[model samples]
Target: MIDKAKLSALAHAVIDTEIEAVKALHERINDDFMQACEFMLHCQGRVVVIGMGKSGHIGSKLAATLASTGTPAFFVHPGEASHGDLGMITDKDVVLALSNSGETSEILTILPLIKRLGIPFIAMTGRPESTLATCATAHIDVSVANEACPLGLAPTSSTTAALVMGDALAVALLETRGFTVEDFARSHPGGLLGRRLLLRVSDIMHTGDAIPTIDEEALISQALIEMSNKGLGMTAVVDDQYHILGVFTDGDLRRVLSQEINIHTEKLSAFMTRECKTGRADMLAAEALELMQRYKINALLIENEHQQLCGAINMHDLLRAGVV
Candidate 1:
């Protein structure tokens, strides 16, 4: 049986080693890092990320992060590149190659073709003196003093350092390009974050026949009928020009009932909320949701510059639109 005490000690050592590896990277982010970002930012073509073995797995994720964050990039396996995949590389593109030892034979084989294409290259390696580093325009040193593996054969601490460096590069490029949340949403439209940022009130608001509405002079009973028919628990009261004058909600009905106001004798204008919170048709559904939460209210009348009621939305609309 294995000794549990030894196993736990080894685990702690691995965590301690990786922590130091990442800490060392903080000091290495200087001129070369900026130069690498400048190279990719100025590239007219896609950034090609190439790596061998385990590094290739990390490289693929790095490429994806860069592409999704506004930098046009994709991963190219170095072995595949040596066998005609090199055609994908162009003079306008920038190559980001990864090799912890800076001596992966498969990656080295494609160095000549990358050079022949005249594409700029950034090298991420442990050894700055290695051939790959010597050929690169910018070298990002991702060296760890030692592998976390007891046998020193597994790629543990080294891989972690490389992945962190890749993240740093992607974030730096994202900031330098002034990439906004909207830009990120454009890339991730099918995801939840994208839906929250891209879906606007206009897309989910109920308009025309679907909107519960009544004239200002309408009786409270008539407004209640409109609210029940539309199933929004509220009705917007409009003026002669269809401009919003007030809003009548279930909450208001409850208040009126407590006061024993004669529902049959009153007009909606007498009981409706006159300074009701409203939203613009073009506002983001997420923003509308925030307003609703802040005001402790749900329904909102959508209006234009003329204050004309164009539509209406509620907390339900935000949920349905995936903005909640």
Candidate 2:
């Protein structure tokens, strides 16, 4: 039977070793690392990453990170490169090749061709003086003292070291290019961050005849009827020209009841809350959420540059739009 406790202990040991490996990576970021960043930044074309096996897997992830963070990059398999994918690499582009031992056969097989093309190449390797490092325009040392594997053969600590080094390279280049979160969002427009940054109020607002509204001179009973009909829990009190004068909410109705005001005989303008929060139709939906949070309000009226009631958005609408 398997010794579950021993297996758990071994797994913990491996995690500790990998953690130490990443911790030791700070010392390796020297002049060569800076040179790698500088070379990539100056390249006029995209970053083409190539590797084999486990290194290729890591390279794919690094390529994705680079592309999402503002660097145009993609991964090409080393074996595929030999079979005509090398055409994807251009003299203007930079090639980032990963090989822990610096002698991955599949990667090294095409070195002569890269040299012939005169494309700038960077190598990540455990050995400083390996063939791959020697051929690179800039070499990043991802040397691990030992493997986390008990047999010292599996790619463990070494792979972690290489991955962290790749992240360092991407982030260094990201700062050099001044990559912003908005730029990052453009690359990941399908996630929550994309929705928060890209979604605007006009895209998800109740406008036109659907907006629940009543004139300031309207009776409270009529405003309540409008709120009930629209199901927005509130109604905007506007003037004849549709300028928002105030807002009446279910909470206001409760407060009026507590004050013993005759709900059937009151005007909405007399009891409505003045200085209601408003947003622009073109503003980001995320900004509307922030305004709602800051003012502790549940609903907001949308206005134009002239402060006319163009539309309205409530917390539920924001929730439906993924703004929450």
Candidate 3:
């Protein structure tokens, strides 16, 4: 086996080099960077990203980030652009090309066509005077002094710099366009972030007949039956017109049993926890989860503007909705 100390040292050195590469990017965020953002910002169509080799991989991710944040974008392989995908680009679109060496033949092959179309071209390359940079409308330098790879052959530090630059562009455009969390959630409706930001208490809560509820005058045994039937492990002790008064849970049942209280006849009000927490229907399920965690409660009743119980939710509901 290789020496453990040598391996550890190598890992730390790689991390240090990558960190420095990212740090060097701060100074390069200058006029050219803003010019690139302006071109993308003013474009009426999508931002078309093209690259070759390892730069191609980073370009794909950059396009994804730009699309998800606010700017419309997609990655077109330079090789494919030559075959037929050049049609994917339009006169209204802006092109962002990536080339660490600024000399990829495939990307260079399409540079003339892009120039002929008269669409704005932005280049992210290591060399300032390279043909690709000199041909572009704006050139954002992503040069790193060293690669994180000790061999200096792999695209580690350079790729990191490109990724960071892409994120910088995405975020700058996102803020300038007034993109909100709701807008972001619309783009990622299937992810956990979407659920946390968009899922509301009303969307998942049990409403109407599904709510486990009992009267304030109900016996302890009646609350247990309601909890069992609804399968929420708790019952809201509500009054006429469905206004919540208290809550009876399995924990209250344990107390009743330990005290040798008569479940068959004892009023649940005497044992139920009064002033139980409630949630608003419009509140985010994530917020409700926060309320539950803060108050150390498992189940919450949803109340409407009238302050009457309308629906019920539990930890299980949040978990099932992927908001836990």
Candidate 4:
């Protein structure tokens, strides 16, 4: 039977080897790296990435990262490119080819066509003196000293090195393009970051009759009825023009009840908290949550551009919308 300690040691060795491989990539970010970035940055069309096997998987991830971070890019298999998928590339685009050995026949097969089209080619290979590196417009070396695999055959450390290098290139280009979180969010609209950045108060607030509201002249009992009906635990006190005068919340009601105030006879204007925090219809839900947390309040009255009360939101609304 195999020793359990040996298995654990082997796992640790693999992790340590991969970590060192990634660290070695830091020194390889030379002029070639900058030249590659310049080529992609100036490309009028999309970046077409091509690779084979494990390199293809890494290339696919690299393409996605580039596309999401302000650089538009996509992956095409090297094998596919050899057939008819080469047509997907254009003169205006830049080609990024990946091959650890630097002589992937499928990638080499398309090199002549790329040269004829006068399109810029950026090659990422483990061999700096390889044919692909020599023929390309720019070359990024992702050579690794050894493989984490004990047999020295399976792509372990070398693939990890290439992946880290790809990430480094993507992030470098992202910084050069001055890409922001908002820009990244636009490309990932279905994600949580997109929801936090793009979701506005108008998108999710309780509008129309859903807003719990009462006139300033309404009795505390009437305000309670509106709050109960709206299920917001709070009611907005507004004037004839729907201008928010204050907010009456369950906390305020409790304070009033502690003073022996009669709900049927006390007007909301007399018991409501005059200094109410308000939000705008155009504000982000994340900003609204910050406002709620800062004031230790559960509800916020939303106003339109004209400064008129238009909507309202409570903690529960934000929570239900997954904005909290």
Candidate 2 lDDT over 1-324, as tens digits, reads 999999999999999999988988899899888888887888899989998888999999999999999888999999999999989988899899999999999988999998888888899898989999998988998988879999999999998998999998899889889999898878888789998999999999999988998888788889889999998889998888999988999999888889998778888888899889899999999999999999999998999999899999999999987779
Q: How many residue pairs clash in each candidate?
A: 0, 0, 0, 0
TM-score of each: 0.88, 0.89, 0.87, 0.92
| Residue 220 C-alpha lDDT in model 1 | 86
Question: Which TM-score value belongs to model 4?
Answer: 0.92
Which 10 consecutive residues of model 4 have the lowest summed lDDT?
Answer: 315-324
- Misplaced by over 4 Å in model 1 are 1-4, 190-196, 256-266
User: How high is the CA lDDT of each candidate model?
Assistant: 0.92, 0.90, 0.93, 0.91
Predicted model with the maximum TM-score: 4
Instruction: Please provide, for model 3 over 1-324, each residue's C-alpha lDDT reduced to its tens digit, 9 standing for 90 to 100.
Output: 789999999999999999999999999999999999999999999999999989999999999999999999999999999999999999999999999999899999989998999999999999998999899899999999999899999999999999999899999999999999899998999899999999999899999999998998888888899999999989998888888888898888898899998899998889999978899999999999999999998988999999899999999999999998
Model 4, 119-191: lDDT tens per residue?
A: 8899999999999999989999999888999999999998899899989989989999999999988888878
> C-alpha displacement of 70 in model 1, angstroms?
3.1
lDDT per residue (tens digit) for residues 1-324 in model 1: 999999999899999999999999998898999899899999999999999888999999999999999999999999988889999999999999999989999989989888888888899998989999988999999999989998988999999999999999999889989999989999998889998889888999998999898998888888888999999989998887988888999999998889888888898887899999999999988888888999999898999999899999988878877777
Residue 264's lDDT within candidate 4 is: 96
Query: Model 2 lDDT vs. the true structure?
Result: 0.90
Off by over 4 Å in 2: 1-9, 256-266
